[model samples]
Target: MDNSSSSNITSSPTELDLDNLRAIKVLGKGAMGTVFLAHHASTDPSALSPFALKVVDKSLSFAADADRRARWEISVLSRFRLHDPLHPFLPSLLGSSETADILCWAVPYCPGGDLNVLRHRQNDSVFSPAVIRFYLAEIILALEHLHGLGIVYRDLKPENILIQQSGHVTLTDFDLSRSLTPKKTVDPLPVCSDPETDFVPSRTFTRFVCPRKKKSVTNQKGLRKAKSARVSPVSRRNPGSFYERSNSFVGTEEYVSPEVVRGDGHEFSVDWWALGVLCYEMLYGKTPFRGKNRKDTFKRILMMQPEFMGKPNALTDLIGKLLEKDPTRRLGYRRGASEIKEHEFFRGLRWDLLTEVVRPPFLPSKDETELTEEVKKGGIDIREYFDKLKAPSSPLWSPSLDEQRHNVSLTEF
Candidate 1:
């Protein structure tokens, strides 16, 4: 964030004393690394700019490509700093620091947490259509900017989308993102679902007619809402997990794109497919192509199509176009997000005014101005904490975030 500066200290990657930083609390802990809310030890902890510090233990045996992935993410964050007026929906690198035992970087802390946690707080674990549109619009712009820079965000799950204090969002965790040179543009292919008017060549899944199980509704005549899905953008892995065998695949299972699943090459279009899945999930409270397990899930993603309940609508139509199994014909494949922005569903949207919107659908109630008890008490010393961790006899007691909000599957390494 431009407002908060960790630049002076982190810009220079050198060993520091115990007096430089204070760890507020463990924001999250995973196999790859741990995230901490930290403020400068030099200032009044309560009235200073705090940042989320993602520390990757260089010594972890299971974190394959730990240094590379961490550096890639930092490099990507570094790239963000170069943009004149940074994209409102993307994160900025506060700064970065690395020592012999750990690699850590800083970014603005998102008080509202991730999208999945927000969705779970909703009445039925789903967003209203209006709220869905607002969030999806922001996410689209974020992806649009990333894709514009030739960086493909392979992982577009709710877990990576964070709501800012201003109620806008910033896409986080770029470790899975890859830079791809887009294919040369051709005359955009026109895909028609009707068999009589179909012009798509080498069709794999033109129209999936498989029946879907519908929920009992109070008003039986009501149509259901749209939901979302993705492919590619593989995540890193730890050793000896149940899904260690499928290291060949990438991206989260439920959101992965069809081309990625089939070993076909993918580019920017994969993110668009994931956007569709996100929309579907926000509207319907579930992903469109989920099955019993990883194998069955990939099968459904390949052979089946998402089904809609009640009547077809503009949102559903957009989702359908995005979910096209053929990557060549999927919406935004050739034209990028401009193609998606032009869909009937987003006909009148003002892209330029997105950041200006004051009241977003969701906002973080946690006041950053007021320091929490952990922060007030001058919490753990980061240097000492790492020093202890570097010891062979360091205690093992790190907990994962709430299981309900996190979808843990190492199927894609």
Candidate 2:
């Protein structure tokens, strides 16, 4: 983490040799970053070729500290390189490096921007149930791989899943991802080891609880006890480093899992809970338990009440089981994915067959035939907009660690 070189990484693609890849355009922009659509520098367009490249903006941070934060992001993404070759659903890693203002990592480019963008543009905002299940199955396999390696993808929103031109799905954005292993080391290093203490209860919980609790309970002495009993502060330190928590709000409120919202310790089951939320959204065009505000949203999530309107009975049942407020009663029931797969919703799902199922219900339109017409029509040119984003003169733009550690918004995304 001390290597300053990584923090001030150069964004110049000169080192990356993009000669192998051609920039098509930008995908989308967010507070912290932008995405681009790049093709393999060497490819025969007429024949099958290498996948597209995903270039993430490392310039989202504001200063040296933001640069340091970018380094942490780099560390998180680097972990994916360790994925087992045999893993069915893990995305292929192409290459990674630090840029002055962006941390460039190349991976198989997914042509589809994200499920959210796709659905939002659709009139119905819903996908076929079979198609949704197909993607879920892949995600389950990916989640299993992440959990096996101690990583947790805290942000599981539809925006993070990309549908490829070939109709396969790939997970992206490790900025919010983390390891489940405590940072503490059994064998101490010369420096103090980061204990597993940096556990993020999950952004899923931020909008649900006030972190601090107080009540007016009175004792038999007819005297009120201290209005606020002392409770351990949720550790905000990233057990590994003295840096403050990186995200103010943990998970998107609409899709937060119960255990995360309640601040009860959570394990990998939280991811499953998010998957359930995603499935529900995919089928219904909205969250099953949305509220007008954070308070109401938390109430619904904590109460475990979701109105499954018009969803298939199988999906409905699966969502119900996964959304259980009590983690103990969650679908895995501590047995893990085995129970999930065994559920009636997944009765016909063949884990092995599902991975190789190449025909997805949805895919990106690849015929460039309409490209010129749209350009002349003054329609959105997402690709060029993204490519034109100025390389930041400073480190990426990240909220102060304090902003991330505290002041989590209860309503905003």
Evaluated with TM-score, which candidate comes out highest?
1
Per-residue lDDT over 1-413 for candidate 1, one digit per residue giving the tens place of the 0 to 100 score: 11112123334333333357778877887555878888777754573677788888787774546566677777788778778897889988876776677678878888899999899999999887667777887898889788767678887988889989888889988776776533343333232122333232321121112122233463222311211112222311211111112222457778888877776556677888889888889888899988888778889999998988779988899989999887656787645676777566764455555676776777688655446767777787776776686677778345566322333233433
Which residue segments of model 2 deviate by more than 4 Å?
Answer: 1-15, 18-22, 39-70, 84-88, 120-123, 182-249, 310-312, 369-413
TM-score of 1: 0.77
CA shift of 139, model 1, Å? 0.7
Residue range with the least summed lDDT across 10 consecutive positions in model 1: 235-244
lDDT of 2 by residue, 330-365 (tens): 665344565576555554344554544445566678
lDDT of 1: 0.69
**What TM-score do all the candidates reach, one by one?**
0.77, 0.65
Q: Give the Cα error of residue 26 in candidate 1, in Å.
A: 1.0
